[model samples]
Structure formats: structure tokens, C-alpha cells
Target: ATLPGEQLFEQFTKGLELVFGDKPSLGFICGIKEAVREDGATLPGLCCIDAPYQLDEDYWGSEYQCEVDDGLGSLIPNPCERISPYFGKISEESCKVYGGTYCPLTDCTRLQECVAELIDIARNENRTAFANYLLNAPNITDPENSFQCGWAREYFGFPANFINDNQICEDIKQFRNSRDFEFLEEFFNQGSSSDEPGDDDDNFNVVPPLVLVPPDPENRDATEAVSKKAEVQNGQAWRATNFALESAAKTLNSIYDAIKDSKCPCGGPFCVAGDICKLVQNIAQKITVVGLILIETSAEISKFTYGEVAELGNVEPIQTGERVKAIYDNMVLTGNYLQRRFQGVNDYLERMENRLVRALAPPSAPGPAPETVASPSNPNITFVVRNGVGCDGLDQDGDSVEDNCEEDRFPPSLRLTSKASTSFVCEVDYCLEERFRTQTEAITFLNAVFDVVDDCSAPEFVQKVIEQIPGTVCEKTRFEIIPVQTFPENSTCADVTLPGISAIVELGLDTSAPTVLCGFQVDRSDDDRRVSPDSKTLVIPSERKSSFVDTLLFQTTADNCPGPLRRMVTVQSNEFVYGTNSVVLINQENTEDGSVVPRLFVNPQSCADGSQDDATICDPDPVSDFRFYEVKISVTDAVGNEAVDTCRVIVEPSRRRNLAKQTKDSQRSSSESGKGSKKIIPIEELLLKVAESNVRYTLATVTSEVSPSPVA
Candidate 1:
């Protein structure tokens, strides 16, 4: 008549009893339920038991057919197999209702592998924090070799024993005498009861309490009696403190495990954002709970015999006050370690949040606009200079007011262009005169001022503009713009000499960046061509007696009249080498003379065997029909102004002219003439010129002779 769910719960309880032969504490039962919930398992609910039940796989093989390889050669029960029996009858539909699904065992294996990797990463991070902070070790310059930073055995690799081993920032002698460490060591110790101090009559029992192991039915009552007597002798307050310490130790272990489990186990280049968010939430919640438990336990421990209330007690504390202080300090240090871990999680979450915001931000909502705005009437106009008063001459519009007279309603527009060859000049005087003599004059004045300053409305220029006119305000000035003759580079005009009051003004300074000139020698043939007159494009034949040499000329010009220049060239292909002996050197000499134009010598092949050097040999035939190399040239002037230009060098495949035969024939002819054979010197030696030399040399001709008859 009982319900099926109730039957399952009854069976589960009976199984526990059969193993331990006694009713377990309510906390122990609840602990199991909590573990099941944390593991994310669900099953048919009974009021007493919400956790799912696993079928006896050994007895019921057909119902739980699914098995996974344990990474070893052995197969083990998979989650699907383990959860199948909770449904009473296994079915894909029923299993999926509780979030279970049948999948290849390999999928489960991969998940486990990923989890193992995350656990390893978590352990490494924890080791680093422990080494750097808790141990008070030197800063880790290299994280990969930081193991030596802490106690050698405490953070030793694998099967972590950090919490189990001795670890405190201070000296071991001091730590051993500390009260906080006494409780910690005793709580986590795995040794049997014999290792503890003797428990005889008249002796106070300070040993940490252990869960009672179920004895034989005949001895059960007696075992409980002894445990009860011991608790009474110790005093209930002392017993409560010990229990709290025990709970605290367990909680610490849980925290360590939680850190390992909280990491997302996706083993791909990127994980799902939702999964990462879930991982962040899970870790934060776990840490929060663990922190609360430690705080509560420490509070409980502080209220003990040797704690704050020790003076109020009738009996003196069994332990010393130093022990309490030690416990408190150790708790603080534990919190420090936990805080380090929390900070890592916090940083990772912040980075993820920033990335999410950037990726999800709306594209239509652009950032704020810049300060400057172009005139509505003419986009080219950079500024509009307005005068409070305007108007000049007799009326041409046939109105009561003179045509070019009376206050003008609007300001004149200023346009800057790159067309002018001379500096612009502007005149500023009060009145119904004119803002500009002509529109072209306004444009030229704008060009000059703009070249000197980026913004006319800037703070530095505002005062300068006000002082330019004699007793004339910026708003009242007329003939605002005029043309001025160009001065030498770096020169500025001073002191306004207009027929007016004294006004000091400075104008016309060159600050613009220099320009670089790049050119290449042109070649014309079936294998080479100059499609355009510009130096930007050129074709050259690869076939040559020794190596092909191409001259790349460079020049740099700055506004401050040409000065000493530094030139650098970079070829964007493996087919070319530059400078002396394949080493590019920057010019070090200081000279303004134009005769020494900075030149870059490029040799496609510098050896007779068509090699760039002794180490690299090029194929007698080109690798491809045509290869294009981009040559980038940069130049810097004495004033630090820099410019860069690029040109394309196209290389045609070699034509195989049989130069060896020609050389042999030439050598024979020279010998027959009784001139003797000329030694075949490498052409690269002739082409490789000293970089500092003033003179230049070119290989215009190459001749060799071949003998027709043997020289007996």
C-alpha cells in the first residue's frame, strides 16, 4: 500500500544502516543530500530523500548497460548507467526528464579529462599564492620556477598536502608553541587515538573529538556511555569549541575542493559566455559560504575557556591564553590565503565583463564628436572671423545706407588650402574698412596661420591675436587677412609695422614633417619593363654573369632646409640583400652637401653560384615566373622629422644565357694571344663597396677567354 518513492527512501536508509549498523546523525544524512545537490543530480522525490539512487550495477547489468573507460584499460559505470535505476524502469524519455541522456562513453571521458585539467590549474594557482603570500617568500620573478619559494615539502607536486602539512609564515619553533596551530594540527591529523595524550581519571581531555565508530551491538551502549562521560568531564563549553574547530577543519577541506570544481571544464579555445558566467557565480557563492563558516567557527572558538570570557569563568582554562592568540592569528592567515584566491577570481570576472560589454555594445551609438566644426556654407572653410562693425564706401544697392557701408551682418569665412607658394599675410584694423581685401586673401591667410598652429581658437593663440592690432579688439578688426611674402625656413616675422599703434606679433615658422624621395633604376627588355614613368614600379631581369645589382636612390627633405639625413631600407622579400657584405649600415657622417645622396645597394644575388651569401644558394632558375618585392625606405632629418615611401621591384625568371661557355671561350682567346689566363675573381668583391667611401664604382664590363688548343 506504500508509495513507490517511499519504498525507495526506506530501502536507502536500510542500506546505510546495514553498512554502519546504527542510525547516523541527522547532520551526516543532510551532508549527503547537500553533496548530491551540489553534484547536480535529480531523481524521483521522496520527502525524506531528494538525492537520486544508483542501481546495483553488478546485480542489474541489463538496466545499466552504459559503461565508461576509467582512462585505464578498465570500464566503469557511467552517470547514465548510475542514474538509470532511479527511474524504476530505464527509458531514454524518463532519463532525460531528470537531465540525464545516453551518450558515447568517450564524451564522459572527455568531460572527466577536462575537469582533471581544471583541478590541476586550480592547484597550481593555490600553490603560487601559498608560496608568495603565506610563506612570506621572495617575489616570484618567474612563476614557472617558483616552487623553491616556499617550504619544500608543503607545496610539493601532486596529491596536494598543503593544508595537511606544516605551513606558517613564522619560524617553526614559534608556530609549534602557538595555540591556533595546536587545534589545527589535531583537527586534521589522520593518526589513530594512541597518538593522542592519555585519557585517565583526573586528566582533562583536550584531544579533538572524532565521530563514534559503530561497535558490536553488545558493546554499543558501553561505548556511548564512555563518550558521554568524557564530554561531561570536559565541560560543555570546551566540547562545543572542539566541535566548532572540527567543523572548521572540514569546511577548509571543502573550500579547497570547491576551488578545483568551480572552474569551467570546456577544453576549447573559447568557452560559452554563459558557462563562464555560471562558473564565476558558482565560485563566488562557494567562497562566500566557506568564509561565513570560518567566521562563525572563529567566533565560537573565541568564546571558550581561554578566550574573552576566561576571566568570568569559575575554573581556570585547561589551555594557555597563548593558544587562543595562536588560533586567532592562524585564522587571520587562513583568511589571507582565501582572499588571494578570491582576488584571482575577481580579476578574471572583471576581464570577462569588459570583453562582454565591448562585444555587445551597440554599433549605432558612436563616441562623442571632436571640438572643431567646418562652416556650413563651405566645408573647406576652417574658421569664420567676425567683426562687431562693418560696411564701407558709397551705396551700390540703391538704399539709404551706402552699398559697402554700415555695419555688416555676418563674418567672413577663412579657407585653408595647399595651393599657395608664399606665406599668407593679414591686416587687422578697426572699422567699416573690410575683413579681407579679397576671398583669395582670406584663404591664403588661413593657410599660413593653420600651418603654424593646429587650432586658431587654442588658448595660446587667443592672446596673441588680441595683441596683434593697435587698440583694436578681435571683434572690431577689419581687413583681417592679408598676404605676406614667404620667408626662409625656420624664420618668423616680428613687430607689426602697420600705420597704427604698436602691436607685437610673430608669424611664419616651419614645423611640418619632412618628405622622402624613393626611386629605382629602370630596365627595358623582353624580360624587364617600365610600365610607368614613376619610380614606384620597375622590372629587372634576374640573369647575370655574377649577380644582379639594382641601385635604389633615396633623398629626404625637411622644411628647415636640407640637413644631414639618416636613411634605412627594408626589402620585403627573401630574394634580395642590401648594403656592404649583406649588412645594412646607417650613415653616421654629418654633411649637408647634396653630392652624397643616401643610396641603398640591393643585390638579388651576390655570388657566382647565385647565392645571397655562402650559406644560401638560389636555384639557377628562379623559383617562380615572376616575383615582386616591396622595398620600403625611411628617412629622418636632423630636426627629427621622419617620412617613409615604398616601391615595388618585379623580378623576371633567369633566361639561361650560358655565361660559363662564353667565359671559357674568352679565357682561351686571351691565352692564345699570349696574355695568360686571368683569374676568375668573384664579382661580388667588386660590387661590395666600402660604405664610408666618397667614390663610387660600377661593373660596366666583364670579359673571360677560353683556349682553343692545349697549352703544352
Candidate 2:
């Protein structure tokens, strides 16, 4: 349901008015509602209206004749007088709300005097002094804080009700009462200074430096010491990322210079063919800009971390922790990625320079040997050489052994691989124990490292500019461990005590994405239980049904990273039937004929098998003169949520048994032959005879029989 065009315009005008002010004019926008004269007479539609207005009450709204210049270059006279009082008019107060200085004509005497003093004060005084003066002025009421006005009351202070409710006072109060008052104050105080000291050209266009404001202690739930330490760590991470960007910038500039120096026109000794030089130059420029944009993105991301970092100490912390952790992780990962890219480009340029030198060298002498630029390796990571990896000739690990060679001496370890086949073995022994802890602080430091072995390098440049360095194929195994209860919360021998009775459930996981390796650590009061070899499935004997409740702990490897242990609870009951909703009567005999019929129970067949000697009742004495028993069935999910339904079972005699009892008469008597007992031939068969005489006789006999009944 969408609002009509007029209604939508009215609502939008109302909201805009709340943000700015009613009756404030700026070009097309006039008053929030329809314009009216001083006598309360409504003005005509848009074309006839005079929209320009002033604060002075003597300036009564009026209508004026007008003409519009159509785009086709002809002046068309308006059909009606324009009565709107705000077209093309600008409001000084609205301009101030938008952070623009508004200068009005001196001829507007009343408004000039009214706002002249405040305008002078704003220009002469600093923001703090002006805000203080507004807040503490006499005859001015403090701003209201009522929440009924929505964000207007929350983000901005209520307008001060000064003498006569001057509009300027409200704007001042809003500034003083805003949540961003401190930021605005800092902007006004320090943002005005010249970029280079002692040189003042009034370059007000310069954006202010980013200021990090520590959140309130109440929000963070941290001691003063811990808060200070977190701040220090935050600053350090930022500086390190900034330094990486700076180095990247320098490398891009150097690359750009080298490309420019190598460029030459065609037919020259050093000339490069085609657009290769132009292409390389373009790539260098794009990469430089990309680095710059990343730096800006890093700054923007830092701002989002304030509230997220504070949310770490909240009782429910996973979502916030993941968000903040991603920031730190991305920073580190991007730093490493940039380092790899810069190094690759530098190595390419060095080789090109050496090639040029060889080309210019004397033909009698051989070219110098190319330098072997080894790939940089992280200290936190270990490497292993394996067989049948990519690019058989290259030694990626610098071990002088090709990755495809089978006789590698390195030991097998957990390897983290990227989409590009860049593999490294990361041994973070502590991450396994602490990664899944509910406490965000447990993994904060490690998450900040970014280089912590994970699948962070899955995204790669698709363009040819990205070097296609041959990398080793990574061989690593990862699995997710899930603990599953083999039975319901409360169950007897029928559920799991029987052989081959184990609860199987799907956890609704993406089985195709990650391998699931399941195992369990069971803790139960009963000793009479059996566990599967993998420790994932548990079974308890019928005798130990009463105490089969167990807690199972599980651990898993989260693809290229360490995950924490998870716990699941399993329960069993001594009772054969877990619950009974109600007793229902099912007649065992047909009411009309007193015929007996047998019915089967819907519950587990074992519950009705009396030979098992379980608590489940099959046929009980008449309850209210009806012989019946209750059959209960229940289903539970992997997470222990359950639904149960029950029905009554009635017992009766079998109808088949009654029908089998009827005996057959064995005696038989001989009978004498008679005309009435003789078989009679049909008239139609007699008519089919081939002889004409016999056919006529049969027809005559049929006609006589019919005539005897009636002459029809």
C-alpha cells in the first residue's frame, strides 16, 4: 500500500520541516503545509503563488502574475496568479542548520537586527564559548529531552525556549545538545588551522584529521588498565598497516618511474614494441590508486570498530567478535598480499633491467647470470615439499628439491592453501584450545595477526597483470566434529538398547563444503554402555536405562584453522513409554453386527510384545467397561526438541475366528426327475435352427404364450 503522490509530498515536507524548520524557504521548498494569507485565506495553486517570505509579520502573503520560460525558448504567461510565498526565497536559519553561512540583504531591517548579534558572536567566538554562552544564557530555558519526538530529541537537544521563542536559539541549542558536539567543537577549533604553519590562504576545504574517541567505560565493561591496553594495541595495529601501505606506495612510484624510463619511440635502439610500455604504465597507475583506496578503506574500517570492539565484553559475544576480528584479519592478510604483489613486480622489473643490459653488451661476451630472487617466507609458517605439485621445476620452499619429486625429506604437517596453490604449514598450538571460547578476548590477539594460517587468500586478481607464479599443490585435511545423541531425552530399551538401534540425524550442515569427522567423549553414571569405534555413536544396555544420561564433548578442525570443543547432552529413561497425551477408545467389535475385528497399535511393536517383559501395557482390564490400553509414540530432533502423541488401544475377539467356526452339512438326499425340473430351451435358440419348419413352430409357440397373457 503506497501513499498517493500528494500525501507522500506532504509527509516528506513534514519530515524536511522537522529537520530544517517550518515556513523556512530555500528555492522550491516553502512552508510545510499549504500557504495562506494573514487572514487565514488559502492561497491559489503553485503557478499563481508568491513564495518569497521574511520573518517580519507585516510581509503579508500575496499573489502575483508570472510567466514561465519553457525549454523551447518561448515565454508562456501563467493561467493563474502565483500565490505561493516561498518560491526562490532562502531562510538564514535553514542555511545555518546545513552548516552554511547565510548573508541577508541589509534592506531586511527587522531580521538583520534580530540575527545580527548572534552572527557576530558565531564569527568571533570559538565553538566551545558560543555553545557555553547559549546553554547558560539568562531567560533561556534548557533544551527538553522528551523521547516522543524521536531522533530529533535523541541526537539533538530540544530547542531552547528563549524570550519569544526565537528560532536562532533552537539552532544553537541543537548544536550544544548534539551527541557529535565534541566532534563539531574539535572541527571548529583545530580544523581551521593552515596546512603549513604561518601560511594562511583560508583553505577551509581541507577535511579534518580522523580523531579516535574512546567509547564510554559503561559500554566496554573493561577495567581502566585493560581499556588502555586495548587502545594501545589498536594504535599499533593501525600503524603497522599504515606502514605497509606507505611501502607499497613507494614501490608503485618506483615501478612507474622505471616504466617511464624504459619507454622509447619505435625504430630506436631501446624502443619497446607495441603498447607494452603504455600497458605497463597503466597497470602501475591502477595499482597505485588501488593501494591509495585501500589505505582510505582501512581508515573507514577503523571507525566501525569502536562500537564493535566495545561489544566484545557483552554476554553474547560471537557476532561482534567475528565482525571486529574480520577487520584485524583483513588488514594483516591485505598487508601480506600487497607485499607479495610488490615483490613480484620488483623482481620482474629487475629481470627486465638485466635483460636490457645484456642486449646492449658486446656480442663477443655472454650475458650475466640472472639473480635467483627467493620468495619471502613468514617466520610463523613452516613448509613441506611434496610430489606432483604445480610447476615441477620450481623449488617453492627453497629446499633445492622440486615439489613434484617423491623423495622429499620434510615431515607431514597441516598445510593451509590458497586458491592460487600457495601453501604453508601453520602450527598455532594455542588457537586450537582458545578459538571457540565464548570470550572474545581469548582470540583477539591472534585474530589481529591476519597472517594466522587461514583461507584468507581465496580472492585473486583475474587480470593478466597479476603474476601467474607457479605454486605447489597443497594437501591438507579438515573436518568438522558434531556430537549427536543416539536417542531421545527419555527412552527405554526399545529406543537404543536393541541391536542396530541408533538415532541418526542430519545437522543441516553443508556436507559438501567441509568433511565432518565425528567422535564423542561420554560421561555417564552407568558403566553398562557400548560406544562405536569412532566414539560418535553410544549405546546403553536395557538394564542401565535409568542412568543413561551422558555429556559428550567433541573437537574439530575448521578448514585451515583450529576450532574449539563443543558439548552435547544425551538422555534416556527407565519408562517404556515417555508420555501419554490422552486415553482414546477404539471399539474392537462392529456395533451393527457384533462382528469382532483386531486392531494394531501405532507405537513400537516391541512395546506390545509382552514376552519382552517391558512396562508397556498391551491388553488391560476394562476401564469404564471398555477393554483398552494406551499406545504412545514420540519423535525428537538432534537438538532435543520433541513432539509426542498418544492413542488408546482396544482389545476384542477376532471375526475370522468366528467365521471359521460355522460347520458344513455333510448329509445329501437323491431327488426324482420331473418336467418342471427339466431344462427349458429359449425361443431365440429355436429360431436359429436351420430348418424352416422348426423355426416357424418355435415362433408360433412364443406367439401363443404372449396371446395367453394379453393380445398386445
Candidate 3:
């Protein structure tokens, strides 16, 4: 019913499905067959089985004998003649040409032999049982068994080669190249050898009528030797695989250990293990430095007393020396830590290299030697030294040895003295042969030296000496008293003006001994005059006077002076006192109000005594003989002590004129009385009219009588 090609296609599709689990689509099966054909291979053949309809023993016996004779006669000329006669005969011509008898009977005989051997192999715990079963049953083409053959063919492509070889023994050599042979070889190597046949065996007594002899012993022994060699090679391969796996694991562990011990390049506190620790420390250090600078600068600006004169700019609050020190400390810590971490990383890297070398090389070969690693002990991280100022006392030759450690040398001791005035002297004991780069720098260095001393000194003596120095030292050397002013119980100059009050401080440079003074001067005006009479004159030692004067002149005030009185003081001889030449001048002409009345004045005539050329204005007594006629009154409140009132006496001539007119009108009315009922205007009304009339007259006289036209 079907064409040869069509029938072949159908049989191939059915056979593939039975062997490989499921039937693919017709097109897919056709494609697979086409692919096989393209590669010079043929699809597997399929066969069907049908049961015998009826069996007559006598008849079957005769027919079977005839078939056996027919098959034997057909195989008589074949090279495998020894086993051919065992096949039952079929049509003589069909058997001879197509060998149907040998094809079917040989396959059945092989299956029986394989099954028996497999049972024996299994009972003996032989791993080669499965391999031997496949080998012996090579012609069993039942679909179930064929499916396993197909699986092995697809997996290793060996059974396909065996089939292509037309079942020849030579094909086994080609099939052995497949990966399946490796499994087969491993299985066979682990199996026990087959037992030798004995004369006592009953199976040997009943021989088949047609028997097939086994292969030659020489060929069998050669095959067995090849199998043994493969087994030995497989064991060596497994050992190599294990060695590679272990070496890789060791290398990975070494790398992990190195990373764990390695330090971070950016340093602070080692917080590598904790999350974001390095970032937090970095931010904290930056904030601390910035906060210190801001606080110090604010303190310096608060020293000014007067609201007007203190408005001068360039008064910074931070102590430059302290700021530099803070920066230096942070940098040192960071740099030192980084150096250490770098060393550790380098060491780790070397160890990692060694591990890699060992992994790649043989165990007997020596590994490359590890390199020596080093870390910096002290990385001198310092601030930018400006013009020989704020040197950290480490410059030996005054050459600004900020970058190099070789040039660094300790500075000499600085001595400071506070006098009765509000200014102090800072003296350097070092040789003057090493000249300062600039006068400003010299002043700054000296002031900083004093500040360092003051910061570490006793609290009682700190304020007395610190208050002597004016605020205007160098920008980098100014020391500010925090919170503007503080009142400690044991202060010596509590009642004195703000300019005279000293602040006690420690420079924080050293903990061993007091080395310098950080003096603060209250008065900033050029016209230096003592605010208090009881204040004493301040003096500096002749040698250190220049440093004291320079620092005093540069310090500025926060607010300008409000009233005529200017507070002035100086520090000298370890004391804070009022300045000698300070003057309080009134500048009310520049006030917002147009009034020219002098708010404050010192009468030269009143103050003059026969003793001194300069007149002294002492505290005035309200009940004194001094006249208050021209003096304008200024009232100040107690709380802020700020001026709250301004009072001036004004004599009105218009009121006098109105009074005269009212008197004249009252007299005239009295004389005209009794004759007519007098019109009596109330005294208040009369006074109002007279006042209005006088004002109008005054305006007219000024406009028309004094100047015919308004003055340009």
C-alpha cells in the first residue's frame, strides 16, 4: 500500500519514537532522517512480531528441519561458517542471498548468552556486568534493548559506528575511542575474572548438534591487555584532577587571608571592619578643626568696647598657632597610618605572589624569595609656614624648615613680662644673628611664643599677663578671649575698664612648664588715654619693647566707642593697667540729630591747675560750683550703662514778649472799666492770642525786615 521511500519514513519515525521516549512530529522525523542520510548514515530498521496461529508438533518438526538445512546450506561459503549451521533455515534462495537465517538466529543466540553472563556478573558484584551484557547482546534488536543501544549511540556515537561496520570485529576498535569506552573500561577493570570450565559441569555433557568454536587465545589476550592499560591511565588522570582542585582551593584561601590583614590607604582610626567608620572619622576631624578656628575668631572680635571705633576690620578671632598645631596633629596621624597600611598591603601582595608561584610550580622547586617591606615611622605633616611665623619651634636656622625634617631644630625659650599698662613684652632668648624674615613675622612669632606660655601657666597668673597684649598682633598670632569677657572671683582688675581686664589662658603648646604669655589688650584707639585715674603706667623691657609695641598696635576692637570717654589700657611687667596717653574725644558733630549743642565737653579752664600743662578732667560732682547753665545732660541706664537721655535748656524770647503784651492789655482793660460792661476774656484765652500774635510778628520780621528775599 505504501511506496518504498514513504514506508521507510514511517518505519523510521516509529522506530525513533519507540527507542527515544516520544514520537517527534512527521516533519521533525523527516528532517532527522534527511540529516542522517546527508551524513552518509541509514536509519534503523524496524520489525513486528505476530503469534503462531496453531501448532502441530509433527508438522513443525519436519518444517523446522527443512528450514535448518536451508539456512546451513546458504551459510556454507561464509567466513563465520563455524556458527552458521546453528541458525534455522528458511526459503533456500532467500536465506542464501539475504542470510535471513543467520541474521535472526545469530541475534537470538547472542541475547541468550548475554543474559546468562549478566546474571553471573551481577551475582559476583562485578562492575563490568553491564558492559559485558551490551557487548555480548550486540544483535538483540528488540525496541527496549535497542533504545538503550540508541541512548549509548547518541551519548558516545559508538554503537552507530558499530552498526555501520556491518557487525565486524574490527569496528570495536573504532568504538573504543568514544567516552562510553572510558566508562566501559572502568567497569571491566573492577570486575573479577571469569571462572574456568571444569569436567564436572553437567552443561558440558549436553552439546548442541551444531556448535561454534570461541575466538583464538592470542587475539583475546591482546584485547584484555589494552583494557588493562586504559584502566591504569584512568587512575592517573583522576589523581591529577584531585591535585588541581586542591591547589586552587589553597590559592583562594591565601588571597582571602591577605585581604583581611591589609590596611586601608586612607587613615584615621582603623575602622575597616565597621561600616563607614573611615568616612565618619574624616568628617569629624574636619569639623573639629573648623569649629576651633570659628570659636577663636569670634572671641577675638568681642574685645572691642566702643561701638564706633571698634568697627575697624581685620580683627580675626582664631589663634593661628593653635590652628596650625591642630592641623599638624591630624595630618601626622593620617599620614602615619597610611604609611603603615601601605607597608602591610605590600607585604600581603608579596605573599600572594609567593602563593601563586607555589601553586603553579612543582613542590620540589624552590619558591621566589619574598621582598623586604618598610613603613615610615614619622611623616612630618605640618602647616604652610608663612614668613617665619608660627613655626612650631622646630626651625633651627629660621629657614622655614616645614617640608624637610633634616632642617628642623627646636626653637629657643620665649620670655614675656606684663606691666601696669595693658600691653606685654615677648622676648626670644635665641641669637639675633638669625634675623626674622619680616617685622610682622617677628611680632607674630613672639606673640605666639607668649600665647603658648600663657596657655600652660597657672590660672592665677595667666589673666594678669595675657591682658597686657593688644589684639592686633599678626593675623596669624592674635589671641582672643572667649565670650568677650569673664568675671572670675579672684580677678585683680575686676572694677577696671574692659580694656584693662586680663584673661587667664593656657596656650596648650606644652604640659611641662609655662613658656609664653597670650595677652589681650582692650583699647584699640590711636589716641591712648587712661580711662581710670587710679590706673598705673605700663612699661616693657627695653630689649623686648619692639615686639610688644607691634603686637599692641595691630589688635582691633569689635565695636566703636559710643560716648566721649574712650577706655584705654596696656599690659607691662606681668600686669594689666591703664595707658598713660589715652584720650576720650567727643565726635557728636557727626551724630544723626542736627542739634550742635555739645553733648560732652571738658572745660580747659575748669580743669587747669597751676601744676601741669595738660588739664585733667576728673569725675564731676553734681553739686560743685561749676555752672550747669550750658552743660547738656546725658542720662545713662544702669543695666547696659548705655546713654538713654539727652536734655538741653532752651530760653524762649517769644514767651517773654507774649507775657509783656498780656500785662499791657489787662491794665488797659482795667482803666476802661465801669464805663461800659467790659468784655472779659479769660486769662488763658488772652495768653493764647498774644502768643500767636508774637509768633506771626517774629516770622514776618525775619522774612521782610531782616532779608528782603530768602538767602540762597
Query: Which one wins on lDDT?
Result: 1
lDDT of 2: 0.29
- Tell me the tens digit of each residue's lDDT in model 2 across 168-266: 333444444332333234333434445565543322323322223334557554544454444433444345445555554555455445444543222
> What is the clash tally of candidate 3?
52
**What lDDT would each prediction earn against the true structure?**
0.33, 0.29, 0.26
Candidate 3 segments whose C-alpha is farther than 4 A from its true place: 1-239, 250-645, 650-712
**Per-residue error (Å), model 1, residue 379:** 53
What is the TM-score of each predicted model, taking all chains together? 0.20, 0.18, 0.15
Better of 2 and 3 by lDDT: 2
lDDT by residue (303-420, candidate 3, tens digit) is 1111111221112222233333222222221222223332443454464444423322322346453222222322222222111111211222223332133321211222443411
